[model samples]
Target chain A: MTDLLPPIQTTARDDAVLKALAGFVRQEALGPGEKLPTERILAERLKVSRNTVREALTRWEGLGLVERRQGSGTYLKAAVSPDMLHMPLTLAGGNDFAGLMATLEIRRALEAEAAALCAIRAGKAELAEIERKLDLMEEAFQTRDGMSSEEDWEFHQAVFRASGNPLFEQIIAAMYEMFHRFWEHPLGVRDFGHASFPYHRTIFNCIAAHDPEGARAEALKLIATVEDDLKRGAANLKLSDRR
Target chain B: MTDLLPPIQTTARDDAVLKALAGFVRQEALGPGEKLPTERILAERLKVSRNTVREALTRWEGLGLVERRQGSGTYLKAAVSPDMLHMPLTLAGGNDFAGLMATLEIRRALEAEAAALCAIRAGKAELAEIERKLDLMEEAFQTRDGMSSEEDWEFHQAVFRASGNPLFEQIIAAMYEMFHRFWEHPLGVRDFGHASFPYHRTIFNCIAAHDPEGARAEALKLIATVEDDLKRGAANLKLSDRR
Candidate 1:
């Protein structure tokens, strides 16, 4: 109980129910789009309330793995999963580093394309928003704001939105959500601390100029700095302590 | 609901709950590892029964987006957030074509890495199993087994597993999962009446020989074959449809 979660008192039943279903997925060799049994049956077998089982099912449904029709049963959605939910499953099964690094590469592909698309599709309003977000970062630098990091994330998020591909925005945003911890480090803290807003300005300029190459170069520059900072941290850390 | 999924019913409540949750993710500004309210509270907020909420929550928990503690409460997992549950969310909000292509390119990069890793790390047992699976496909050519298509997937899945990178495996697996639907065209289908197991054997050889370039090239060959088949299908009507 305490070992599995935060030692909460109320939701153990739900957790147990989900555990049962996941166990079923494992043991029964169910693939996506495969439907599970009725709550009455699952509850009777798992020794939980139908309410508990239903709650567990709802959570999974929310995650987009389970698709339900009003009169139809729940079926696994093989294609509808988000990356935010997948990384941890990989981590749990063993392969966190591979997942993270691969994700960074995925980011490079996505953001590079996102910047290009933003340059092409961003309207005056979206571009203005991007510029405004960049300005916010500048203000953060000037005032030494604690939330500068967030400002940075927001600015890029602004770009993803401007790219006009909801899927791009969502996927990149989801990756950021899952990997925020990896991206946030002692070096990142320092980089964000004294980091000039000029790099962001470069991105803004390239985007505003509608220069795809320039935008990509600027994006790469930003990633380069972050990578360099991360590398430096790795160099400075003790062998056993580094992630 | 019947129109959406006519094949099942028990899963509908759970599916609606997930849809509601996906709507929540699409609508809310929740961050990873952020806890929602207790089951009773969340159920009331979502207008679903506590059981429904619990079901969705359980799914999320299994997906690794939320961690459930018996006595404390369920906490959002920072690493495996809700965003990663589906296809690239980043692609959703953007302009068409360009952004979509960019997302696919990012996928290509992931696939390349996964293929390379699979070449390097696949075990004798795993390698042998992949060969066995491929052999099954060869036999399927003779008997016209229903398992041929599925065996194809297992072969790729084995490659991912052998990569020893959970993230790579899962992401690559998901990408493959997404691409699988385009298979049933008249020109393709591994129907044996059209192609043979040798196509997969090329990939197997490269991987077993630990030649990353070879594995990649072989994979490209397979993909190209499928692509050509799809192209051909477009030029001529699907045989099944014609019938």
Candidate 2:
């Protein structure tokens, strides 16, 4: 387990402290629900201040890796297992183009599968919710309300919810901001009106018809359309840069 | 943004404080690198103790959402954009069977796509690494070293690396622990010898041949084989429970 975490950079004392505490947890082979040594003990062991230990513990708690019981002490809420994966693309810093493309690729895979699952498993209420969102998109298109993007997002989220896999919903939800940003201000594509409404409606129709394969195809097509737009936009940017 | 974050269950004062800080950041539309108000000011504004504010900031820092600078103050390191997605499944708690199934389904989608991408993008060196892992798997089988599983994992990881998408690698890497556990002591499945060697070889061959669709098909077939075993194992468990 210790081998999983790379060496901690000693740039910040707090970061080093956090890494040390994580190392301790990994070294001890502590699993979820395990108790940790007291802060004083940890501070003494790591040769760090108690305040540093406290801060690190607090941070771990926030990350959902540990839990603190007021009187009992802090317990390992989740094990930082050696095999656990880390988030590769972070939205924190300015978005990297490669990261953005990688993210879109992932989204395509997930959303495509989600559409298939929604076709097979979506309940009546869920289907209705999706339809309602579609109606809102159409209404926005007709009224020029410029709210189709919001409705479109809701429609996709409805598909995720209908997939009945909380993990899918959660993963997509986690990328919701990135996806939302991409769709609204899509790099090269300017028009956000009813351009993609037909594709979305075809997706809806496929799901409504209980055609998993068809829904998957439609979803992929929809994603392809966006990807094309992004490529075109990127090319335009390049051309402009050259000019 | 409030609509995006579910109500924070007020189980602990610190949790409440954390939620409030998150809310403040959202309401104020804090972006990445934005400076947060001083701890003293935050405590006064949120009506929480300074200790509580410190604890919450520490937690946020741990979560990679904020950064604390010794002399300046704490600043938002990342935007808590309302559109941001949240991780749906956590490996911290005991692994629930449903979560496991959901995770496998996700792995299937990701790995299948990764194989396709690898077929299209992998360079000669990347292909050689994958081939090396396969050779190691075969050697383990012949030697009866029982290290086939590790080599098998390496093979899949190599595919992810070949995909040229760091995000795919990261997501799979995150799920490594779960996948490792699933393969090792799968509910009822045993015999981790060269049983799936043919399927893996076919996947490798497809990639080497630069056949994206074929590689995808082979990857899905490989995943389906495992899924079948898992399903059968799950059924066996259910029957045993009934007995």
DockQ values of all predictions: 0.12, 0.19
TM per model?
A: 0.49, 0.66
Residue B116, model 2: Cα distance from true site in angstroms: 0.8
Native contacts retained per candidate?
A: 0.19, 0.34
Interface C-alpha root-mean-square deviation, candidates in order: 8.1, 6.3
**Model 2 chain B: ten consecutive residues of lowest lDDT:** B85-94
Measured with C-alpha atoms, the lDDT of residue A44 in candidate 2 is 89
What digit string (tens of lDDT, one per residue) describes model 2 on residues B1-243?
233333344557676766666667778788878887888876766666788778877756655567878689888866664323333234422254565777888888898889999999999999999999988877876676444777788888889988987667767776777767666566666654334667888999999999999998998888877777767777767755421
Candidate 2 pairs with clashing backbones: A85-B173, A85-B174, A173-B85, A174-B85, A174-B86, A175-B85, A177-B83
Q: How far is candidate 1 from the true structure (C-alpha RMSD, Å)?
A: 15.3
Per-residue error at A165 for model 1, in Å?
2.8
Off by over 4 Å in 2: A1-57, A60-94, A145-147, A192-194, A239-243, B1-94, B145-147, B192-195, B239-243
lDDT of 1 at A221: 71
lDDT of 1 by residue, A36-73 (tens): 78778888999887776776666566555577665777
- Which ten contiguous residues of candidate 1 chain B have the minimum total lDDT? B88-97
lDDT of model 2 at position B46: 63
Give lDDT tens digits, candidate 2, residues A158-207.
Answer: 88888988667767766776666666555655664334568889999999
